[model samples]
Target: MPFVNIKVSAPEPTKEQKKQIIAEVTDTLVRTLGKDPAAVLVMIETLEAESIGKSGLSLEDLRSKK
Candidate 1:
């Protein structure tokens, strides 16, 4: 079995987008690693902007600067 974990900060993905992500990831693993589609697991974790930081700035702060 192959496990794939993805983390995204804030503004969670829509249901359709998430499904596309899972499908694409599974196809990639199947084609590249020869993993069975049924055996491939994809997990997406959406974290709050406050929970993720970079360069001493939280994701929320960083996005605000944009």
Candidate 2:
């Protein structure tokens, strides 16, 4: 079994978008690693912008500046 964890800071993805992500990621693992699609697990986490930072700035702050 293969497990994939994805994280993003944002308002959150729509259900269709998330489904696409899951499908694509599963396909990638199946093709690249020869994993069984039924045995692969993909998890998506939507974190608070305030909790995710880059270059010393929180994602919330970065978005505000943009």
Candidate 3:
């Protein structure tokens, strides 16, 4: 069984996007890694702007700098 964890800090992704991501990753793994699609598990997490950062600044702060 394959267990996967996914995290996103941006605004909530649409359900369609989630499905597409899982499907694509699962298919790729099944083909390349010989993993079972039905045995795969995926977890997604969403965080606030302040909780995520880059270059020593929060994502929101980075945008303001650009």
Candidate that would win on lDDT: 1
Model 2: per-residue lDDT, tens digit, 9-49?
A: 77899999999999999999999999999999999999999
Decide which is better by lDDT, 2 or 3: 2
Question: What lDDT score is found at residue 37 in candidate 3?
Answer: 93
lDDT, candidate 2, at 22:
99
Between the candidate structures 1 and 2, which one is better when assessed by lDDT? 1
Q: How does residue 16 of candidate 2 score in lDDT? A: 96
Give the lDDT ranking, best first: 1, 2, 3
**Between 1 and 3, whose TM-score is larger?**
1
In order, the Cα lDDT scores of the candidates are: 0.95, 0.94, 0.85
Query: Candidate 2: where are CA atoms >4 Å away?
Result: none
Worst 10 residues of 3 by lDDT: 40-49
Give me the overall lDDT of model 1.
0.95
Q: Distance (Å) between predicted and true CA of 53, model 3?
A: 2.3
lDDT per residue, candidate 1, 12-52, as tens digits? 99999999999999999999999989999999999999999
Per-residue error for 40 in candidate 3, Å, reads 0.6
Clashes of each: 0, 0, 0
